[model samples]
Target chain A: MKATREAYGETLVELGREHPEIVVLDADLSSSTMTSKFAKEFPERFFNFGIAEANMMGAAAGLARSGKVPFASTFAVFASGRAYDQVRQSIAYPGFNVKIAASHGGLTVGPDGASHQALEDVALMRVIPGMTVIVPADAEETRQVVRWAAAHDGPVYIRLGRSPVPDVFPQGAKIQPGKASVVKDAKGRGFGEMRPEGERDGLDADVAILANGIMVSKCLEAWEILTAEGIKSVVVDVAFVKPLDEKTLIELAERCGAFVTAEEHSVIGGLGGAVTEFLSENRPCPVVRVGVRDRFGQSGTPEELLVEYGLTPGHVAEAARKAVRLKWAV
Target chain B: MCREVRKNVLIMIGTAGSGHPGGSLSCVEIISTLYFGVMRVKPEDPNWPDRDRFVLSKGHAAPTLYAVLAEKGFFSKDLLPTLRKFGSPLQGHPDAKKTPGVEVSTGSLGQGLSMAVGMALAGKLDRKTYRVWALLGDGECQEGQVWEAAMAASHYKLDNLAAFIDFNGLQIDGRVEEIMNPSPLADKWRAFGWRVLEVDGHDVEALLEAASYASESLGAPTAIIARTVKGKGVSFMEGQREWHGKAPKGEELSRALQEVAKS
Candidate 1:
């Protein structure tokens, strides 16, 4: 079965049940954000602020003052840009325990167009002091990240996509905050130590594919095609975007020789830009970013836009091959 | 107590050379009535967690709050002379960190009510009985965030919270309506799900009655809209928008003091 970002809502409700201090806040998009499940079970703990995102941010800060861990939900655009000042002063400046659970992140919020799609939310939120930015790969990873955000301190921004994709991690996989999970290897044949049977680990490769959100599944698919063409590629699921697993990135840069970053956000300040900033100082390598260029996306189906913007599995494979060839040319 | 507070407010605003005398004098009786008669506070133990929380959301009128605090013995009465002066605890606006009795730092408009909501929610969660009160300027209602906070307070059923709207009929730019109409204000607040009460602001007995009603009213937030003149008691400054931010000079100060003496 395919994984969906809505699975984070199930995990969030479960976490709220376990911790009495946990509260869920929604801005009239409870069903959309999947927080309605928690609202149904915990009516008293859930707050529906009726289409006011700014007030929701302020109320979340207020809830934090009362020692309640508030998880505020809305579409990514309003959560980041609409209530930017409120989040800055009330939650970020005071360092409140508020988890901004934003769904429909990046261009994956298809058909809603540019107004709803949150392309620069990651960059805008990550720069705030004491803020934890996480972009999980799939539903299971999103669940783990949500649980981690509750256990962690200060403010956290969790980005979830609207679409469903294949599960990259097996059952019973645990997620740690500020740590990167290496889902596929490029240099070796077998998965790292904890490989499930019948799963091929693309370890022997000249370049590594670093992807986040729903793009992780695309990168894995591309890795298989690249391996078939005799161009081995390692796929790293960079779920934690803020604390970009420097150790794993450095190791991959040294081993793979080149890198390709794929995400659903703008190429200017998304996962690709973060990877470039990391590699430029520590391990300089040939890099190709496969994502939205510096332009707003119009209304279209998710698949159409992905192909139009060159964000499919085939695109990743081509980008990986081009990055490897560029490294050799250098 | 209300008369004494009015006298001090007039004196302080008269000498400060730069203070909001209109709203300050308009809210003098309400502030004095709340501080002296209603609120459960301590002069020395200002940060006592169990004490009731007061947030002056219309923070531009610091003279009213300063006068009340002085009368409550939070500080010496002599400190009133240092109002808005260099190195004075009494700045143009109320700074919670600098002043002794201030609950939250409020200078920017429309934020104090939100902080008061936070305090009330804190009391409910901690199982404390301390009530939270926020004083707002009628003109400050032009801010959208105030309505946002109002909605949350009602949705949360913060019966412990009460807000006082100083309907002094004037802001910096002429009357509130001419600047930006916020009329039918009581109806607007009622629509947002608050128990609204309208009262004569300078009437001490009526102010006490409205506060009593708020205390007894449970299961919803309360807003007491006190109607007042731009500047009360001082004949020269009364009903004048110029007095909203300007202070009386050397000769005008003596005349204002004399007017207070006669009252």
Candidate 2:
């Protein structure tokens, strides 16, 4: 039950040993961002740039241009907002080999509230052309994505969490960029989940739950609740939000036809938003987006925030039911 | 050397029909001094591993950099006419990927200094002797990122980093003092623990001396406050804020070209 940030730090140290050019920079949030582990391991490669996120971002661009893979870490809010111009102009525009591994993303940030939580980071990063945005579902996925980020030679933003999340994938589950991994598939369920007789759209899945980050665990819980009710559902872990596992999503859209897109982010421009955007373009269908609905997160426990933000198993199940019930005119 | 580059900058900007001739012409001497005399670069190999990096922080002055890099034989002289045009390597701003000699992409203000700090830090990590230079505008200093970079550069003790502030009193709105004062610039740099050097920007020799001093100074970065004139070398545009962004037109182009030709 390690936090994604802890896995990030450990993976960075591993990458540092393997790739010497990989440098770490932080804006005084090394402890929180978990780059302090890398700092302790490789003092020369780790740069603690105080609390200047903008400068840290700019310096990261320079380092990347100078034949170094730089991972600049800070809280997700500051990284995506305060230094947005720096990230856009210096890193994204130029297509530098810089990785911004931001921590404390989404409602899971808890007591820090909306001011620190970055519900819009995925949207912010995904909008930039050629910028790869990754939201790992768990610690193992975070490690895999971090490894992938180091090897992939372009600007990438990997959003991480402060709180420890449940393990979704196995020990050695390899995460490919822009590919959705189906952790749970509906196989042995009864025919109760199938669409009504003539109303059948010939889709494979009656309902699909697409989620990322801390919400993936809750999605699995919702799948269990649906399974007990004789409803067959597939839970897809969409960690990559930018390139968006487009092929997988399109296949899922063709098969499931109905989706409940859940995430610990703003419903406006997050995992839910990305799914809606993609499906509307290629394959139009009914989508129920389950996330923070146009509201700021307040100080609370991680569990309370998840429930308050409507990101629990109950919310996911409710959205799935709504999506399954919606009648889209073919 | 600077006058020669300034003449080319005038020609290029005037030919492009629209560009920042004032700010571009202001730091002609500083960029010229760095590329022609001070900076250790290879036009033959723009990506030489050990080459000193120069970032044009105030991207409005890209014409000067484009002109200087062309003069240095980094690319063909014909590319200068294509500045700001469609699909041109000589973009409106310096794009490191498109341009051969440009180290990093910079057009947005306050970002170049931070990139320089990163380069300096990289050099230190690699134990390399190459230094990083970033040229900034007086008005560009008002951006909070510049100070953020300033503090980081000093905090890291990056002696391999040198930043030049083009103290060309004018900005687009009006005089820099009128728009948003960034005065007492030298003292501000000193307080940030930089080795401050004030020099007459147009004097190529003084600029060279400042660069050399900055390269040698240890334990901290150096900030050379260069006293320059906006739209310098041209009589009508000099000290005028309107020229901060406007291009020279018809008779103005011919007159500006003629004025730039002279000492």
Candidate 3:
């Protein structure tokens, strides 16, 4: 198990060695956000932004505009909530080439509670005119997404986590932008087998589970429970929230008559919101959203919070079953 | 040159049929001095690596920056009349991508200083001598981000950056002191570790000297508190809060233009 924020730091160090133009800025949260690793390796290239998230964001914009690629790191809450105006005006409005690697996202921020958790970051960032919002599933995916965001010449917000999650991909697995990865495909064959395109065309899956962030692993677990119950399902991992994987979504919608979206974020305007907006306009599948409901989180251990917020494997399996029932009932 | 910029401000806002003429007119001298004489910029090469950067933080005063850029030959004066028009490069706010010489996009308050600090930091990192300047409003300083940027700039010791507040003492509502006052302003900025310089903003020579001094100051960012009159160079609009966002109409325009032309 590894934290995505650690992967982000390792990726920054690697990228710093390769790209001289790459600069790092952190709002006095370097140790926590893991940007201190980059600062130690490249002291001149790193800036201690001194608890000023807004300035860090605006400075990242200025540096980007002035022919430098900047990666601004801070807590998810401060990066999005405290410096939202700076992000909106200086970075998004101008479409500057800045990478915002925000750590400690979602309820897994744990004992820090809702004040530190960023449930609305994806929604806030994706609604902007020119912002690419990304929430990686695990450490390996985080590294690939960081490299991608560094190379891409636009504003990007990459949401990372504080707690460690199980690796979902192998070494050096390239993450494609705006494309969903099928981690475990249980359409026709048993576990860990994919259905051929020809067979997928005729498939009406028992349920399709679309998951992002740390919840992807839980969804994979939920798929196991559902399959043992004699239910055939598909599990997809979505890292990019904007410029969504429409082609894959259409295929999943066609294969599965019902859908279930699982995320560690808020049910309102996260992965669930994006999937629903797409399917309601195109396929009209019944979707069960498994996430934090319309409410804030409280202080607790990360494991307990996951269960309390209904984001555990049991919750995902229940949501998938309910979605399938609703589809059949209709 | 200041009069020329004022003429363009009146014409641009008057042509657009809607703009903040009072604030635009108040910043004429500071904008004129920086573009024409103070800043080391090549109008033909807006993206020159070693050139000084000018950020118009108080974006409502785009007319002032646009007119100065035109006068300094960054772009054609023909675009001056196209301010705020559809498909026009001259937007309602200064867009660095749209305009030739704009350093960064700024309209929202308290953001330009931070951008300038970033540019200065980058210059220090690259060992470049180019200076960065951000023009802010007295009212714009009320934003908390300004202080944040101020802290960062001083913390980083970005002496290569200079910011000026167009202290016209008026905003959209009423007197700035009355509407969310930031009094003891000079002391506050001094406490934030800035080398504060108070100047008569309308005096082009004094503005030029203060800016020149700021460029050479070592180890700390400079803030020039430019005391200016709203609707400067005009009789009826001067110091009148009603003119804060209103453009001069037909008769008003003719009279304001004639009065400014005399100066």
Q: How many residue pairs clash in each candidate?
A: 10, 0, 0
Residues A1-330, candidate 2, lDDT per residue (tens digit)?
889999999999999999999999998999999999999999989988888899999999999988899999999999999899999999999999999999999988888777988888888888898999899988889999999899898999999999998898778765565788776777633222433445433336678889999889898899888888777688888988888888878878778889999888889888888889989989889999998888888899999888878889999998988888883444
TM-score of each: 0.78, 0.96, 0.97
What candidate 3 gets wrong by more than 4 Å, as runs, is A187-204
The most accurate candidate by lDDT is 3
Model 1 residue runs over 4 Å out of place are: A1-4, A188-206, A229-232, A246-258, A278-287, A321-330, B1-51, B54-128, B168-174, B199-209, B227-263
lDDT per residue as tens, model 1, A39-61: 99888778888888887887787
**Candidate 3 on B21-120: residue-level lDDT in tens?**
8899999999888878887898888899999999899999999999999999999999999999999999999887798998788888889999998899
- Clashing pairs in model 3, backbone N/Cα/C closer than 3 A: none
Give lDDT tens digits, candidate 1, residues B1-263.
65677778777876777888888888888888889778998889997777887878888878889988998899989999789889999888887657899765566677778767767776786788888888999999998989989998998889989999999888888889999999899999899899999999889899999998888747999999999887788899888999888888888878887887788
Query: What are the per-residue Cα lDDT tens digits for candidate 3 across A123-228?
Result: 8887888889899998889999999999998999999999999988777665576788887776534223445546653245688888989999998889889989
What is every candidate's C-alpha DockQ against the true complex, given to 2 decimals? Answer: 0.28, 0.89, 0.79
**Model 1 alpha-carbon miss at residue A212, Å:** 1.7
Candidate 1's TM-score reads: 0.78
The lDDT of model 2 is 0.88
- DockQ score for candidate 1: 0.28
What alpha-carbon RMSD in Å does predicted model 2 have with respect to the real structure? 3.6
lDDT of model 1, residue A51: 82
Global lDDT of each candidate: 0.83, 0.88, 0.89
